[model samples]
Target chain A: MEFNRRQVLKLAGLGLTATATPGLLAACSNGKPAAGDGSVKFEGWDYEATLVQQNLDKFTQASNIKVNYTPITSAQYVQKVVAEFTGGGGPDALYVYDDSLAAWVEGEYLQPIDGLPGVDEVYSSIFPGNAEAMTYQGKRYGLPYYTDSNCLIYNAEILSKAGFSKPPASLEELESQAAKIKSMGLLEHPIGLPAQLSDTWWAWVWGLVFASGGDLFDNQQAPIMNTTDTVTKDVLTWLQNAANKSKVLDPASLQLLPVPVDNAMKANRYAFTIGARYALRDYNDASKSKAAGKMKMALVPSLDGKVHGTISNTRMYGLAKDTEVKDDAFKLLTYLGGLDANKQPNTAKFWFQERGLGFAYKAMAKDADVLASLKKFADPAIYAHLAEIARPRNVLGVAWYTEFETEMHKVVQGVLSNQVQPSAAVASLAQSAETLKKKYS
Target chain B: MSVLTERRPLGDTAKAWALNAPAITVITLLVAYPIGYSFYVSLQRNNLKRPKAKRFIGLDNYKALFSDDAFLSALKVSAVFVVVVLGLTVVLALILALVLNERFRGRGLLLSLALLPWAMPGVVNGLMWRTIFDAKTGALNGLMLQLGLIDSYQAWLTSSTGAFLFTALAQVWNTLPFSVIILLAGLSTIPSELYDAATVDRAGAFRRFTQVTVPWLLHPLLIVLILETMNAFRAFDTIYVLTGGGPGDATTTIALLDVQTVLTFTDFGLGSAYAWVITAITLIISVGYIGLLYRKGNFEV
Candidate 1:
């Protein structure tokens, strides 16, 4: 009982070893990647509750994989996912926004799909640019979930009344047609585009920038705003003219976001609106929009010939590296995003009919069955054509996407507001983008 | 009176330390540990995203701060914002406190309504302001149009100057009630005899106010000033929801930049350093003000 100091310490050491061995063993076993059982916890942003449940239930029934889905909103998606990834034991599988997918790849938080069974078919079947969007350093870490791109959705009634039968083919035609519509007093501004600093508006501007072969970043992912390039100057000049000096776009466009611009079209205040092709659901829904039957789809006006640029976003399915059930999660990811969600042929149809999202699989767009399923609602050709050219930019895959987006939007807003010259705006952005490049790199 | 010098018997001393051990441990763990850990992390490369690459870079993060144009710009913006927003908030709160201190009908209702903005969270307040200032559909635009104040709606959040000014106003509104309540309590605590004495001495309203009310309110005003400065300096949520620190980097305050650096970039080391830099700035300001007050003999009240 009255042990010597050496004896006391020896006894204490023995006690600690006995107490810590089991925990140490347990931690050591868990030190490597988790090999989860077939229970799947999936996360996504803003998916319809009932539809998502239906999909999860379907997958569960087919695969015997117990599944749970949490529908996080866009605002909470990154913070929650990053926390889960860093802290460990997060969802087994989740839909990732492309902006943060690269960050995850950089962090090695995703399980590569390059060696997964039947991955070749899943890999080859997806639309163009989708795989590239999820790829970092030549490894595919995610599959395309759903993709949406902006096209000019016009008010057919207004266009017809203004003496034109179809949407404008080129940027000039767009301006002239808009002027005609303005002169006819059909609307104060004929074309509606979101001018505010948001991803929604950036999509439109970015499309034009890409069309003219200009990019915000160089091959090395550095900021390369070229004020001298016709690509950059023309885009800004057109925006300036439309917003301030011309009747083509109203001053209101400078202040409007995607929703209000759509609303203005719904109210028949403008002839054309640049937005996701999926919004055709709302545009054609009589209950939601006043111009229900009047909406028509067309490519956004090109600077030269065909609409060569489209700004699109693809939701991706990434398996959390820490998941115990990596294989099961991959199964779930492929099932939902890869092969029409467990070969449910109606998956694409359901997405198109319910949520207005396009198919990830290129073949799904051309599938006779899928087209037949949607023939009652929208034309098959538009979705198929849009899918053929669905090229979305991989935003700086670094953690700086959020901050860069905020400033990028402001730069576009400046151009729209006529507060800064086109050259000045680009120059200002060059500095911020440089900072972002440095921060994220 | 030296507790260390007046040492008791060994058992007594041991017992005292034993009794105080829990409190001391809790303080160390809760307060001392985070502060010390933050300083350590700030000096290292502890980015969670790049965990394997993490290593001590020895004040490289701090060095990066000075050359960082964004951080420097954010600091400048925060300095201006703190002065303007805190000035407007304290003055307005004082005015309201004075008005409410007067005996009036429905003072209870007015006070309740005045506290409404405070009751709401910053996010909700920012959202409400967003809707109010929305260029196309906002009530503000509609009212201005109806009043013929302008031909069309102005992009209030889309202009740098307008955004900074409006965001400052929103900050003042969000933080005013607390300052008002403090100043009001300070005003009420001043004995009525002082006012009575000033009245008997035929002190005019302005003279009585400057001679009696201001000096009496100084202590609470200093508290208000300190708290308001800290709160206004760290504003993020409202600015995020409202202007998003934009129309360009016009409103990118130091606090917002720090949060962005950490949360957005997932660079905890750099973010921790940014947070400490802000802390140092605030501490310096607080210490300098306290020192000035002490020197001026204005520390007491």
Candidate 2:
């Protein structure tokens, strides 16, 4: 059977066409739902990925629903996930930072979970502030993954050595104590606060502002922190004084993010700092820190020394709008964030017992196992009280908040560096917020 | 043999095109399409978070950039970074190339050592520099303290000037090796007789270098200038890791700003505009370098 030249050419053409057809067809198919494999795709920032996978496996075993888990670097997670969603392919269920919820919802990347099964029960179980954080435009979109507030963390040994038995209750007291510690040669900079231009920085800033009883925006969402008498200006002034006049704030704080700040605390380089309440567990871990068992948490120091308020931040499990397997995805979400079939907050309990992670569920505060775990690293009473007083940021649900937060980082940096005056920075930030609001509107 | 003869129906140009078709197709898909799409995106308001707001705004994004404080500050910062890094790199690379060109002991080892920085990823280089210059536990502070340079550790990266200079130094270290390799190749091709003739003319060492070495290396120098200029303009990873355009926009290059605009702010149109401006600036600079170094379709020398 000798083939002629024409027949060979015809066969080659047919083979080439066959080889390319599938790829061409796939390229033409846009916005198509993923294959109905009954598997839910889940993504979160890289934090204890091993534990997350183990938990996911547990869910799979118990519920018999497949879950594909992906952990992204915390620094790149938001942008990478947003890009995936914009390109019309993303996880069915994903961890969503409260700050990004409004923007994501506005972009139509996330669907409201108000109608999902057990949604109301989950909301009722969590703290009201946490529930509010998971809602945007009066619609619930997620269940709380974790909730925490920024507190004043102190190195007790350093404070004791510096002749202080208790933590400072006011910003002035904190500055004076830090200066004394610095003067005693106990530490070059006795205070550490994250001022790096990242999400952590903005969170800490909001915590400070809230602790001082200042609001970034009013009920109408108009910028109100620019006023001369506002606590926002006072907080900036205190930071400026600490960084420049008193020289008590670590200069390296300008370059440090949350993780590095925690590391610095563990190394006992900072006598005091503003950090998440959850970090206390890591701070007191003997295997991980030299300053272990010497760290203590106190209410965030405020201007008046009486009103100790701080910003409560929540991370939630949200469902993507384009997800075809909504039921399976919601099951995964509930298993991770809400409750198990036994109506137990198993995931929340696991996170708390293992990592000292704060929970949105109020019942966890009174759970005997959780209380016993809290005793190992933290004071249960102080932790519970901090949560009771913690309020979510009013601007978290604004579509333009992220852009405004970026600008605020730069302005605060300028203030810390003494490049811009505190009042000037406040005014500039307020102006930036106005511009972003108008742009988004 | 028959198949080869059968291609006679196709001309040489068509045959060449057919052979190169795969490469051309890849370039069109990977390179040309992205560039064209970026330019198209630049003319519209394409914010991912504000999808409904997207529309053809016709150069409004570019117009807004000139008035944007962050963009302007980034431009100034980029200019400083490029000028300082390029000037330092060119001089250091030429000196190292000249030194390496001479007969020396352990020349191969030294050459290999010089390229170690180039072998490293940009992020690693930035991290290395950060550790060296860290305010609290930096090796530089320890070394300086041992030498009595200061009584206590100084915060080197806290100031705008310090951050800019150190970041520029890191860029120079990462880029100098490639420039040295190019100049070394150029040095190898220089005729020995030219130097001998300069010596016979009683030209001094400086005069010989200026008259013989520089003229012979003009084309290579031009290549280094254009490449380094473009690299310095668009540098992101190292700067991002090192300073993150921080301590108040001290190190925010246009590339970093573009990333923040597009990824952080999700404003693609403005980011694309920033990217186009960078490309335009880099192209103009490359053209200027060529105009200065080349004449009559050849090196001026």
Best by TM-score: 2
TM-score of chain A of 1: 0.85
Off by over 4 Å in 1: A1-38, A183-185, A189-201, A218-229, A247-257, A260-262, A305-307, A340-346, A372-379, A394-404, A430-441, B1-32, B294-301
Total backbone clashes of candidate 2, pairs 3 or more residues apart or in separate chains: 0
TM-score of each: 0.87, 0.96
Best by DockQ: 2
Interface RMSD (Å) of candidate 1: 3.1
- The TM-score between candidate 2 and the true structure equals 0.96
Residue lDDT tens for model 1, A175-228: 888888888877777777776544322677777676555677765556667634
- The share of true interface contacts that also appear in candidate 1 amounts to 0.37
* Candidate 1 chain A weakest ten by summed lDDT: A28-37
Q: What lDDT tens digits, residue by residue, belong to model 2 across residues B1-301? A: 4555544488899999999997999799789999999999999999998889889999898889878888899999999899999999999999999999999899999999998899988999999998898877899999999999999888787788988999999999999999999999999988899889999999999999888888888899999999999999999888888888887889989999999889888889999999999999999999999898865223332
Q: Against the true structure, what is model 1's DockQ?
A: 0.39
**Residues A112-204 of candidate 2: C-alpha lDDT, one tens digit per residue:** 998788889989898888998989889999988999998899999999998999999999999999989989999988998877666443667
Docking tier of model 2: it is medium
